[model samples]
Target: MKDKKKWIIGISACVLLMVSVFFVFNQGKSNEQVVTEYFELLKKKDYKQMYQMLNSKTVYTPTQKYFVEKYKEFYEEIDAKNIQIKILDEQDNVIEYLIYIDTLAGRITYRNKVGVKNEQIQFNKELIMDGYTDGCKIKITTYNPEKRGRILDRNGKVLAEDGKGYSVGLVKGKLNGENDYGQIAQYLETDVETLQKKMSASWINDDSFVPIKTVSEATKNDLINKNILGINGVKISTVSIRTYPYDKVASHIVGYVQNVNAEDLKKHKNEGYNSTSVIGRSGIEAAYEEKLRGITSGKIDLVDKNDKVIKELCHKEVKMSPQDITLTIDIDLQQSLYNEYQNDKSASVALNPKTGEVLALVSTPSYSNNDFVLGLSTDKWNALNNDVNQPLMSRYKQTYTPGSSMKPITAAIGLETKAIDPDKDLVAKDKWQKDSSWGNYYVTTLHAPSPNNLRNAITYSDNVYFARSALNIGKDNLFKYYKNLKIVEKIPFELALNKSQYINKNQKVSDQLIADSGYGQGQILMNPLQLASIYSAFVNNGSIYQPHIVQGQTKTWIKNVFSKETTKTIKEDLINVIVDENGTGHAIYHDHVILAGKTGTAEIKQSQSDTTGTELGWFTIMTTDEKQPILMTTVVEDVKNRGGSGYVVEHTKAPLDLYLSQVSD
Candidate 1:
């Protein structure tokens, strides 16, 4: 009886175990459950886990490395973001789902199906629902790059243009490679080995641009000057690249271009910039980079193993064509001005006083901007950057004392405040001091008029007349007129200018400082741009035209900075400064063009008694003829031993003459 009871208990335990096994097999994960896990891994970009979930049964299965690389490369190139997946439907062992991916190129969305086999997902190259890159590669299709815009002058003279260059390279057809390698190396200034490897390129044809080293116009001239073109196989060819026609003539205004570096890549990430891309480095090129560069348009393609295009996966249509930029500058005037001051450390600004359009902006001792375009050699770059002359600096944007140029402005202020009576003589001496409080400090002048009235003061550039005027107007009222010139305020311009200031930091406050400033010396500063514009107020009926480099309508910046009476009186005084036989600037007087001008000299010294101080010479001139109106302000450093303000006047007359001859109604 005991043996029969034990045998029945064992059979009951076996029956319970069989029931549990059947229940577990029937409840195995459905297709939806398994595929959901696979997509969860996909959304995370967990390639390893996602690959592990893919079954090996499909012919479309790619190796783990290929899969990971494809996703990474394509996704990175597109700047993929915000991936999402949702189950759509299920049939048998297959599960259908919608996948959405956002990319820099655009958003991608599609419906895809996946198979679940034994709780594992089947691989489908078309899983993204876009045609799978199978037996094909991801191909990048780039359009003809937008032609970078040209920088043009008022008459459409091109200063900087795209798709033009002089490429100095070897001509395979002409290369007598045997005996000519040495001569070629010498002319190209490159070693023989580099040429050899470059020439040995399997695809080299007679017309190939072998070595294709682009050269600046200056460098091209150097090659000609050195007689380098006589060598066998050496040739210069026109190629597609950025070119500066005038080279250094407008370098400070046009700037240059350079290949994008790591810093630029970081700053412009996912903004269509790459390592090979070129960017504007300074000047108008940099200021209007977006407008000049336009939009980068291209497409992505899926190609077969043989490199034939299977289909286009993404396409970016061209939107904005590069726009040509037209400036108010007359290239001829710019060239003429640059040439006149090329050898000096000087800055010049020329403007249409009637319209306030900047005609020319010149900074002397300039370096060729084209050198940067073709890629500057380290030695050349270092030489330019480290040169004592600072050829790279834009001098017009820098500030300096206005010297006697401040006299007219000062007289205007005095007249506005009723501090000066034009008809009455102030009875000031050529050498003067306010009182015994001035101590040893005395204000002196080069010329003392018979009557120190307003007209004679301006005509002779009397320092004492304006120095006493500063004390009359007082500091509070003094800087008020200057403030209208944008002094202490940012000048609204495309390019930046260092702020003009008075009473510099840590400067000792005293009547001497104020008196000195009255004559345009004591810690006073103004850039060529501000001086030119303020001088415009003298001719513009006591108002200043807003300065602009672009061809735009004349906009009044500050209205009624001076009354018309003050401007009319000052205008006559300035005209006398140039017209009078005894005037200081009479040296530049023209018969046909009634030029009004002032000459000034700012003494730079370490101490009040320093006799060895340098002087910055200034000459500000403008046409009084309304039909052909132009204003030019010029300054040159270290003019003490060089003729003082007379030196600046002499140099400025050349460009002024050239412009007058070229002017039209």
Candidate 2:
């Protein structure tokens, strides 16, 4: 009896639908108005209102939540905006209409029909997508995976690319028992017994080319020469891998790729990433990941409730070719900087002051990015990770005290705030203190020149002069300058940089600390890029142009942070630092080209009384010659015992001379 009643109800519903179809003849206008209202709601992206107008009693009708979610998801997926709808005609309870919507994929127009029942919309796949049937499945077809994008220099020199490397193989069956496996191990700088144990599996066949290790280019040639039939059984095989052409020269800038790990999979979950995928680990590879990876191309298909062969919904996938990242770096200059500072624990950044493009970035004791891509052994990986010089670290992004390089900036701030009279002399002595506030510490100058003034102080790197200048500027006023210079706010950059800080977190700015910071010591620390940007302000009419690595439009991070007069004053003083015979920066003076610069020696110590401490040498310079208007900031560790800031000055001159001579305006 229950089955009979259910059949009766089903028949009754069919009858009602037929009645409604007939009823639509006279109520066509009303149904058309309701459809128009439904389309209007869609145009406004009012999914809830559109769902409320849907015929709830329709068979296979989804829940209200699902109804709303589907519409929202479809619209969002298409990035639909600026929707327009028009009625075409009316049929037996079905309204034909046209819709034009703007989507992220671009503008699209389509025609479809929706059934109107009792003045409510029959919302289904047809309403969502033109000509697509309800209760259908999308049969997705994936396009073949393409190569990840190449990292290139400004002139398209490959930095990182998809390439191949050779592996050293051992055919166990061909190896004579008395042969010198120890000799091969010695060649690889590895233990012979361990190498033998790993390759000596019982399942080895005669034809098996078991890979012993990936050999370096130098080692691969030696292995190829030694590949004999019976003795060592060493064979070389080429395997595909990501390769860094410039290797350690561009390691910190180009970075490297590695096979996706659990963490990577988890972080990029459901984004078409899997175990076999390789993700960028750092540099441009990491920064422009999605762009380099390219979009997945696929097709959508429509099906019915009973799973029948259906028409294709959409034929083409959203195909995006893997985009190459072109950096603004001049690779030759990058190499030059690397060659100049490779021996020292140093970091350097070169920038086009006129355009704000980062010309090059170099960090010494660099590691080969290729090693990571080809795969690192436990020992090799641990050695790189545990190295004292931090071969794998990116020092360009790390913060170091700007030292006396901060003097010129401090002078700018003081001049801007009217705290210093540029023409008048500062009463800075060889040693001085502010009221001797119960302490044994005093602000001292490295070199004492009679009648110390702004130009003389900068020329001599008079620390006491700048210390008194900071006191005159005061905390509030000094911080005001820092805020304008982007020193307070984080500078927007693709690669992460530790923000330059004036003091430790939550630490109050004491008088002594402020005085020390005035000369780039105390708690003040600066990223190489930030210091380069700050130096750029002098040549940029007192506006700091933001430093960018990727090739693109130049933008100013802050405009007019310093007045033109103030910039001119400081800029001239910097030039004097290089031009004057007595200046600390005169070591880099050239007869043909005038270079504006400042030399800094920042002391690092646990306490004021600590005699055992290290000093970082900093040489920051901008070209005064119009034809070569670039600036660079270089900082090297342990310059205290080796001529202090003079070490950096002497090393940077030749490389920059080469770069300037080769580059045309």
Please list the C-alpha lDDT of all candidates, in the order they appear.
Answer: 0.82, 0.81
What would the per-residue lDDT of candidate 2 be over residues 7-92, giving only the tens digit for each residue?
99999999999999899777655877898787778878788888788777662545777777767656655556788878899889
Error of 2 at 356 (Å): 0.8
Question: Residue 212 lDDT in model 2?
Answer: 66
- C-alpha lDDT of candidate 2 relative to the true structure: 0.81
How does each model score on TM-score? 0.74, 0.76
Instruction: Give per-residue CA lDDT, model 1, range 1-665, as digits (tens).
Output: 89999999999999989999999987998788887777677667787777777777673545778777776666666666787778888888788888787755556777788788898877777764378765666666455355788899999999888756687888888877547787666655566777788888999998776754677566678888887788767888776678888889999998888879999988876667776688899999999887888876667776788888777766777677788889999888899888888988999999998888999999999998877878665568889989888899999999998888888888888899887788888886968898998888899988878787889989998898889888998877887877766688888888888888877878776888888898889889988898888889888997888888877656888788999999989988989988999888999999888888888999989877899899999999999889889999999988989899999888888889888988853
The Cα error of candidate 1 at residue 174, in Å, is 14
Residue pairs in candidate 1 whose N, alpha carbon or C atoms collide under 3 angstroms:
none
Cα error, residue 584 of model 2, in Å, equals 0.6
Question: Candidate 1: global Cα-lDDT?
Answer: 0.82
Report the lDDT of model 2 for residue 126.
Answer: 68
